[model samples]
Target: MSYPTSSSPRMWWTCTYAPGAQPFRGLIVPVLEEWSKSNVSDAFPFLAPIDHLLGSRRRISINLAKLFNFFDQEIVQRRLARTGSGSGSEKNNDVLDILLERHAMSKLTRQEIITFLTDMFIAASDTSTVTVQWAMAQLLRHPEKM
Candidate 1:
């Protein structure tokens, strides 16, 4: 999770967050939560027409756009750093760097890079590993609850 950075004085760096920083209270969590739920269209495919009226589908689209935009900005920032315009370098300092390296050679498309970043972000999120940690913390807080 820690990426070595040439930026002196800072021993290491993180791709998504600072140590002990809870950043999941953001658009990513909401969009993911919405996606995890059962949609009306999932139950009845023909009712897709009513999706517009229901507005749930539109909400997901909007959130997804925002999510993609977030990743796009991250990519641009990392690309700048990788090119020496920002604090990063062309070296494989992080996953983004590796992806961008391949990207520069046309080995990967922009969409593919973004998708990989999205997966990495999601995997780094609390929706998986942190779930167990959180449950243990809660159990310790209220021993009777366990």
Candidate 2:
């Protein structure tokens, strides 16, 4: 299956002021795909040793951290700039705005905002893609149902 086209816009609308660009797609899609792949260590505890030997878990963690940093730099910084500038035109009505508001009030740190935005993107994009894939598969298998 191809990558979810809607995921980029959805994540941009939800967390970034710069919706025109979708640099995060490169990082997010592959990371999520890698994460979704089943690993032998998951099925057998004894295989965990080999996972470390293969550096699989370490690679995943590093990629996740990279994804998190991308979201932080792209989304969080843009939101902070817009909110900090006190410009009405830059105002956002999305989750990022709420998180930035919290950041302004000292209720959340920069890292927390980044983490929340990353989590939101991953959860929303993955869920939407899986749901669409399942629906398409069902329709293909049972044309009469559609």
Candidate 3:
């Protein structure tokens, strides 16, 4: 939850949830699966699984791209401007703001932004969810050993 950083001010890093929170997902998922069976013929019965997979992915992508954009607009452009070439500033206070600002003064375009966001979304979401699932499964099967 908290770790030491080399930076002057020790940053209080925040994870979305605590480490033990993951195994609870495994328990809740099984309960949801059982419930889905009873409502299988209902209109939104299949939403649980589909959303569990897709929603995490989508949000992660959007957030990460926003993160990169903020840095690009804030840190990168400021450094670039010292050379009298890039003279731009972002309107907002985020990663995407910084990136969009730099892009306005540099070579990046909308197409690249979309492509990067898409790839990052797919990779970060799927890998994170699957890894959590696998770890939880293993822990459930070997609680004593763990």
Model number with the top lDDT: 2
The digit string of per-residue lDDT tens for model 3 on 1-146 reads 11111221111112223454543233223322333243322458557576555455455445555545532343444445434554433133444444455567776775565455335433443455557779999999999968
As for model 2, its CA RMSD to the true structure in angstroms is: 3.9
Across 1-146, the per-residue lDDT of candidate 2 in tens digits comes to 44664455453455443666667776777777777877888999888888788877887788888887776676656666676887734755666667676877999998887777677767866787789889999999999997
Write down the lDDT of every candidate, Cα atoms only: 0.63, 0.72, 0.43
> What lDDT, from 0 to 1, does candidate 2 have?
0.72
The estimated TM-scores of all candidates read 0.62, 0.70, 0.33
After superposing candidate 3 on the true structure, give the runs of residues whose Cα lies further than 4 Å from its correct spot: 1-90
Q: Give the candidate order by descending lDDT.
A: 2, 1, 3
Better of 1 and 2 by TM-score: 2
TM-score of 2: 0.70
lDDT of 1: 0.63
